[model samples]
Target: METAPVPAFSELISGTQRSAVHLEMRDVYDPGSRRFASWRSGHRENPANRDEWWNPFHSVIAEAVARGVQVRRARVVSEPVSDYVQFEYDVTFSNIAAGEQVRWLPRRRASDLALPGNDFWVFDGRLVRLSHFGGNGEFVQDEMTENPAVVKLCVEAFERVWERAVDHHDYRPA
Candidate 1:
């Protein structure tokens, strides 16, 4: 009897032999300056406004790439390259093949900014896990994944939004 492969997020980032790591950061806009209060309406009510809060999306990415993660940035709507979905999977798979790390940030329209479904784990570029974040910085929903069909659906939604977005690097926080 053949055994079904257990899907793992780290496996995708670490490549086959563990020599390189590839990562893709897909977001509707640059998150460096996006305040939690604005992103999360709940936060707006309490209004703590820490002020110095930094989005881990960028900093963690910088650290990983600086530590040798091959990072790629793309939008879902990018032309001359209509295969944003394929591009994302390829990036994830290739990075995993190189033993590198990959991260994805897909924006969803929801009331809470910290919502987890905004993120995903793709192995070597293939979808592995689907997760959602809630209002309190917690995983609101988590599904054990690695099903290709499921991954395609998620990636498709990401591409749709990516196509309409401007590049992540175009913005600079004032």
Candidate 2:
């Protein structure tokens, strides 16, 4: 993992050959974004309309999936979900359409498991791209690492959460 010139999310995922697993532990990330505002204002993106729902993020994921790279995302949220989490739930069809498997785990169910301090994506079980967020749920820069100890910790943590989480389609935020 190279941190000097931090690579984009697409670069990280493209470099992966086998699998990419992401563990998102935040209930509200970037809470003041326009996307969330639009959703709150009763503006929903129609999945059928690619022009309306497609974006760079989805494009990269779809490309990776076409190349046989398995992508999975697991989120840990509070029991009574935050507004942002509900918003995320409503927009997850795009992720599904892009070929990413998503799951959600309640914080209560994760009490016994050891988790990382920040969110991250472990690529091919070797490199880890850690997500950093401000105290106010604002977007922060990401850091990448290839330390064996750190990678192992993230991989294990992600697997633990993924195992306990419910599939996105079945998860009913509450």
Candidate 3:
């Protein structure tokens, strides 16, 4: 399948009728983001303060969920997680607050799974957008694929991780 430029997540997620599942396999993502700076400075926002923490991304998620889309995300992280992963952990409350089902799995537990090479969101079990990133954790590109083989692999990988992962509320950043 030919790849397309990154489409708006709201559009992609909204087009789904049943589910949109994301699998994040990186320990670090965009290590240079300003959000991480705030976290490092001991300035993590309180999740309960919706006025302070809610953003467009959250709005998109909320809308999708309101329309009955099942939005789920699973992360495979290292034990004694990297600072970047911890930063992700800190901000994850917004994801949950926005109606996402988030979970975390230590990498050691994923050794037997056949995961894809990149992070991806599989929407409705029919399409996938593979998120590519650099070694420094910066965004590179997003490739959208409707290939049945690839979609099957992604759904299988996400379900495998989801089955093994701890719910975000119960997961303490290792």
TM-score list, all predictions: 0.37, 0.96, 0.96
> What is the clash count of model 3?
0
Better of 1 and 3 by lDDT: 3
Off by over 4 Å in 3: none
Best by lDDT: 2
Error of 1 at 173 (Å): 7.8
Query: Which wins on lDDT, candidate 1 or candidate 2?
Result: 2
For model 3, how big is the CA root-mean-square deviation? 1.1
Tens-digit lDDT string for candidate 1 (1-174)? 122444444443344221222222332222222343243333222213323333334444445555565544332222222233333332233333323333333323222222223455443445445445554444455344546665565555445444444443342111
Candidate 3 lDDT tens digits, 42-143: 897987789987989899889999989999999999989999889888889899999999999999999999999999999999999999899989999889
lDDT for each candidate structure? 0.38, 0.91, 0.91
Q: What's the distance in Å from true for residue 7, model 2?
A: 1.0
Candidate ranking (lDDT, best to worst): 2, 3, 1
Q: lDDT (0-100) at residue 2 of candidate 3? A: 74
Worst 10 residues of 3 by lDDT: 1-10
- Residue-level lDDT tens digits of model 2 in 8-118: 888988888899999999888887888899998999888788888788999999999999999999999997998889999989999999999999999999999999999
Determine the C-alpha RMSD for candidate 1 after optimal superposition of all C-alphas: 12.3
